[model samples]
Target: MDAAPMDATALLLADSRFPGGGHAHSGGLEEAAARGLVTDEPSLASFLLGRLRTAGALAAAFAAAATGGGDLGALDAEFDARTPSPAQRAASRAQGGGVARAARRAWPSARLDALLAAQPRPHHPVIVGLLVRDPRDAARVVAYLAVTGPASAAVRLLGLDPLGVNAVLARLAGEVDAVAADAARHARTAPEDLPAPGSPALDLLAEAHDRHHREEVRLFAS
Candidate 1:
């Protein structure tokens, strides 16, 4: 029997089809691919792997914290500081703002919706943390978001076969599982002790994409 509270429901919320504005963001891969930071399938795999390894790690921790009902304010601050580039920060907020708008209207969780309205929009992951039923599920939510959101965006950018992307994601299913487990474990940390967000290159990419505007536009602006 399924033991998870809102497990099926959470899956629905995180589904790419929810129209929560995730479709609009390419997770900086659009910019990376155009700039040749990512070109072929191997590069695509590597890029996702890197993100899953570091940013994914931070996200896991944050989700865990959220599930655990840790200090959201501190997590919010940590998220802001970790995101160094102004443009990437803007993009993150943009995505967050949109998601907040949509989720508030559709799902209507009092705790989460109230938090969304509290000003200085909570980071997307944090906002997501609020909607989910428990603090322990944050990492799973992040993994679901990380995999689906980017994979959906990648389909639009690369014109790569859809089946291939699904296959790729499936291949990394173990990695995703591990990442989620780590994030959940880290969420157990004292709010003060949560791991800082890593991956300077991603921040740099978002910042660079914001400036190096050209014809081949991908939505990931720093």
Candidate 2:
């Protein structure tokens, strides 16, 4: 694909406004904020970085892998293996189903429809990967999601300056590009060989949030 077209596609997929159900989720920032781990800008930045490195990297790899039109069912299973938290898994599938519905309307790909019908609720990264044809663009989409979701959450949950939060995302843009490049390199690798980086703290937060938020009303979904 041409550079301009590739970037445009990536931008469309990365847009938070794109009906991907991302607004409902905070990438576990809600739980961290409730626990006082991300009380301020610096702490929030730390949490975002940790998420970008672990969850972000893994999502990018699987997204890149999906761009190649590999076995999406197997890829979804691999994503489940990487994600230990059932709540997190459900959130991913929720977002995935939403994105799949939107992608069918916006992009209208037979492959996307088939994948969605087979899994019903594929992982978020998998649907995103199948939307864009370029593996690099797919990686970029996942990397953008990794930071933007939490950044938005910080603004709503902590009342932090939106400008400052955007700045945090801007500062990490280079790192996002680097992570996407690394993930793109592993597109041809076996799905099992794809990175399975996990964040124990985030997983624990998700589990706790799932249980606690059942009774208590929470702002974010997960």
Candidate 3:
């Protein structure tokens, strides 16, 4: 059977209801919210914006790389090396493992099940890209996934109004587009050129969250 082109598949793979385990993650927003860094709508807006310019964009690049027949192992290592904390890596791997199992069931194409089956582990963004039909399609799926998980995590972590976070996504539509465009550009850059600089405060928060022993902690530092 022929595969669908990038544009059509982009919508399918990026859907919030994609049965993936992405719902459990906050893309590190849970920690941010806990620290009062993203308590309300405006703060949420700024946090989302910062995410786009940094790690979110880097995820876009990895998704693009995975989409372009790039090696999954290489992408995994690159993402891992860029991540500053061990807890962040563990969280990502957990998400990636969950999503990879989901992909083996959902798409089952390009021999993805077997491909993921062979890994030490699959990264969420890498698996996310392969689920789509092309790099361009992968870009949308990963970007939307990156933002939504964190936003969802925020709502639960802070007890913020659910409708408000959705509104945040709705409000950040243009910024999302800007991030996507930048993601596309980064997709083609050398692996050495990928963005690795993340917020120092965010990193510190994640590290601190580990020692707190809270039942609601969701700090995935990287």
Candidate 4:
């Protein structure tokens, strides 16, 4: 059977070429690489899998909820609560701010204006949810980005083959879809009740990366 048509907004946002400043963030992969935790394809795969289950899942759920609609302030607060590390929260908002700027120019709407009015720098997933609209599509876009950014970082940091990295992403397609599906299931769930899957290791990595970024020259912002 043929695949269902992808939402256009989801496709555009998920594109690596999107001028969303995502290329400057490694989704914590930079720190993981520095620590040798993700030095090779096998290790990278493991890191991506763990990240997908935790941080990725959390992002997907929030994106789904945002797409389904609710109190934007409540959603922002709930998302902030789930992100324990201050550095991680900063990175999220930074990315969100970038996407918001591009989105306002490309797809100006009352919904987008309301979101920015409520929280000028909304969480990345929440902004994505507003842009994409479809719960599953929004979830899938963020969930895909959650790993792809890091995967690309692996290629640049570890000198891994691009083909190999693409293959690794291909291998994880099922997991990504599963995460998006689970997130869509709770699209209309109360903001306070959204999934808050935590990744202590990622949080630590993000904090460390922030410190290192400040003290020395770092390639990616986060």
Instruction: Name the top lDDT candidate.
Output: 4
Residue 53 shift from truth in candidate 2, angstroms? 0.2
TM-score of each: 0.86, 0.96, 0.82, 0.98
Candidate 2 lDDT over 28-120, as tens digits, reads 999999989999889988999999999999999999999887888889889999998999899889988888778777888789778977998
Give the RMSD in angstroms, all C-alphas superposed, for model 4: 1.2
Q: lDDT tens string, model 3, 42-156?
A: 8987887777667677777777777666666667778888878766676667767777766666667755865676673577777777776466557667777767777877777
Q: Per-residue CA lDDT of candidate 1, range 18-137, in tens? A: 666667777778778778777666777788888888777777677777766666777777777776777766766776676677776767766775566564466777777666745446
Name the 10 consecutive residues with the lowest summed lDDT in model 3: 213-222
- For model 2 the TM-score comes to 0.96
Separate clash counts for every candidate: 7, 0, 1, 0
* TM-score of candidate 3 relative to the true fold: 0.82
Clashing pairs for model 2 are none
Which stretches in model 3 have alpha-carbon errors above 4 Å?
A: 1-9, 110-114, 186-188, 213-222
Which stretches of model 2 miss by more than 4 angstroms?
1-5
Alpha-carbon lDDT, every model: 0.70, 0.88, 0.68, 0.93
Candidate 4 per-residue lDDT over residues 46-161, each given as its tens digit? 99999999999999999999988788788999999999999999999999999999999999999999989988899999999989888888999999999999999999999999
Question: Which residue pairs overlap in candidate 4's backbone?
Answer: none
What's the lDDT for residue 178 in model 3?
65
Candidates 2 and 3 compared by TM-score, better number: 2
